[model samples]
Target: MKKKIINGFLQILGIMIVGAIIGYSVGKIAGDSLSKVDTPNIILLLIAGVVVFILQVIIHEAGHLVFGLLSGYKFISFRVFDFKIIKDENGKLKIRYERLAGTGGQCLMRAPEYVEGKFKYRLYLLGGVIFNIIFSIVSWLILPSYYTLLFALIGFVLAFLNLIPMGFNDGMTFYHASKDETTRFILHLQLEYIYYQSIGKNLLIEKPEIVEKINSLEITNTNYLTDALEFIKLDGLEYFFEFDALYNESRKLYIERDDLLPVYKVELMALLVKLISLVNPEDELLEELMNDKSLKVRLKQNNPQTKNILATYENGVKLDDEKALNLINEARKIKNKAPNLYIQNLEMKYCDYLENNIIK
Candidate 1:
């Protein structure tokens, strides 16, 4: 809490300094001309500018806090000037707030992990923007022309700018959280294509039982295929092949169509071998897979698909052990080299699995 207060004070102080610099420069440039008119009025404008800047920070963050609470998020802590402190009740930390510098200013609302469902997630993310827009609109109507116009501009900028559908922005997070079906489909198709390419060359390793297992299982729809492919991509061929083999043996049911499988068992075996290489940098399989013509063809064709698949994987899965252990292990090995692609899935999977299998 003390830290938050101090940080808030620093932020306000920084804004004031910047405001002062701008005011001083403007005053120097037009001070003589303005002196001929009204000294007091000019001073008022200067104060207004500084106050507006500071107020902007407060209102912006307040917008986030207001909407966050409305959307059912708990407040952590708030800072005004120059103090930092934390409040805890029964070991549950009180609300916390962090100032987001870019994207028209933002505050992260850390909700409890138990808060699941898309509505809650969406509300939490969009809360600040919504409140900012509302405040801006109201300020424009009520405030005098000078301040009204400024507030309106700030509001418009925050709303539209934050809505850009890209990394770390609200729009991207919202879109992924919403689980737009088209996005999911494209992602699924792309991942399967990548896996197909990765394994196209190693047909010689005859794992008949595994082949027979995957073939027997009923992978009826594109969705299931996508899920299966994602599992393989994250888990690596070793775990996937075992799972597939087990699934096949358990189901012993035929899929309605051959095209449903996308590739044959021999092809899958080769693909797994190729994938095994990429799983770990030090693994021997990389060289052999790299040289294989069929694998190269599939990889080239599937690169785009892989990217989409990765995005979809991120959107749907929240890191858990049973879901993507291989990805987690690889990421752990590489430190910062790990891609954010499957981290969420790995965390959720591990946590859930451990909770159920080990903790329980």
Candidate 2:
């Protein structure tokens, strides 16, 4: 309670300080003998401001994309507001229209493992802010129009704000990721697997170092990294039952931190476990998870077909060949991206096996 009050006071104090500075800057600029513009010109200036602001956001995300791809990371998805572009199973980019909670835009990339790759991801993390700073400086130099000046101001503020290490922002993740070798190493390997999967490669993969670290179990308490490693290790394991134990373990970890956890992220991971582990999740359990008002709402909004498929998977044992095939067709026919493509493909593969069709 005391800490909250202190933090709140500090936030207000900082806002007031910034406001004063901005007011002073405006007064100084206005007093410098600037000519008054006509109403039409003013309207054009406002439109330019809006256009430049949007353009800057695109430039910011592009920074991350450029740095990430150059740093041995593969692009997974790029989202701007409700529009997302994700790589499909055939390694083709597919656009999905969806909205994420409390986020404006993001570029997701998967990092590959390299033993000597230290501080490499820092560029990917700070790419947006770095680009923002450079762009602002260039804009100030090249175009000193009022709209451009406003753009530079917003750009500088955005760059600096992204540096504050809080929430799910790049700064906090970068700070945590850069310091933790075990977690970072595991993530690299996991991403490497996804890269291979993107090109239709899947195999049982193991890393002794990762296994040893997981077994030791004496890491930071309730870390997302731990949850990630716990679940990520299950990838590409052929035996369905092998995934069951880890699924439970990871699910427990996720449940403990459910409130703070990103729902779709963890649930998508859970879907992977359920499908790859080849366990037909208990009907009650499936209902409990998918029926959870929060997840249900998201699923319905993002991919109603996926929500149907999950419910279908829970009752898979009862569905005959035609029915199972129909479900797979329905999911695949959906224009938007599946919530968990890996899971969807796995389920479809399982259904095909029942249908006695050769899977390519």
Candidate 3:
């Protein structure tokens, strides 16, 4: 509790400090620009601000893509807002629409092999910050116009926001990478986990060593990325058909960790619902989860896993075998549209599990 309080305090304090710096810089730049030119059009300036902000977000993610490729990382996806360009299972780049809460953009890459206890990560992690700083400097010094000043101001603020180690920002992830070897190793494993999924590599059967490493690791770090590591471990357990252990671990994580990313919370809850349905159909937690709006939203998504979980709930808990069977069929068909081979495999397996084992 004390550690959380101190960390929270530090995060708030850091944000305030950066806010002050940005405020002062913006004032100075705006004053200087206004003194040199006539009154600027407010409507035009607002439009320009919006355009510049979107462009900066693209540049930021592009920085990660550039630096990651240079560091031997392979591209997986690049997304800005809701638009994404992803390397599909066919090894072709295709446009898709997806968005996560809180982030404006993302650049995902397949990690290089972890050789000799090290892999290139520093430049890739700091690439966005570097690009933002460079662009801001250029806007402020070379292009001395009001619009350019606005661009500089926004870029400068974005750079500092990401540079500070708070929340789920790149700064915090980089901080862990720089200071903790375990975190770095976890990151490598996590990235490799995704890479394997993209290629339809089953970690349980084909990459048992990876699953063993995941099972061996203790969740010693408080980082969300570490939480992600733990998440895949639970996933591996499910794939290995370790139901009892998966139940206990999933329950413990669900009950104890309230600070999980929303997506993780929903995923874990879905897992729990399946477990509870198989074990004790009338479990109170099942009712609670069923009533949860977030869970409902997740179930409504067009993903196969969601349909499978709902199938399990219907079959095991509600004794609606017909509905459950229909859901299983739907899940199987939906698996064809899964984002990657890994997910497609899991979805198919889960649908089979529901049909053969869970449903009466």
TM per candidate comes to 0.34, 0.68, 0.83
Residues 1-360 of candidate 3: C-alpha lDDT, one tens digit per residue: 688789889978887887787878677757865688766799999999999999888888988988898999999878898677878778987675554656899888888888745778898888998898888778777767788877877787788878888777789889987767778887777777777777777555676686677667666666778888768768778777787888888888998998897778987888899888876776677888889998887677766777777888888888889999998888887675565667778779778776887434
TM-score preference between candidates 1 and 3, better one: 3
Candidate 1, residue 232: lDDT: 40
Question: Which residue pairs of candidate 3 clash?
Answer: none
**Deviation (Å) of 228 in candidate 3:** 2.9
Give, for candidate 1, the lowest lDDT window spanning 10 residues: 335-344
RMSD of 1: 18.2
Ten consecutive residues with minimal summed lDDT in candidate 3?
93-102
Count of backbone collisions in candidate 2: 0
**Cα lDDT tens digits for candidate 2, 51-88:** 87777777788889988988877788777777778787
List ranges where model 3 is wrong by over 4 Å: 1-10, 37-40, 214-222, 240-245, 256-263, 291-300, 319-339, 352-360
Per-residue alpha-carbon lDDT of model 1 for 1-360, expressed as tens digits? 586568657756755675566446544654454455433466666677666655665666676677767766555434433221222323343332222223334443434323123235556666656766787667755643544545555555555545554434666556654565433333333333332322231111233343443444444334322334433433343333353443333222222322222233324433444233223334443456456675454443222223222222322233333343343333334322111223323333433432343223
Instruction: Give the number of the best model, judged by lDDT.
Output: 3
CA lDDT scores, all candidates in order: 0.42, 0.59, 0.80
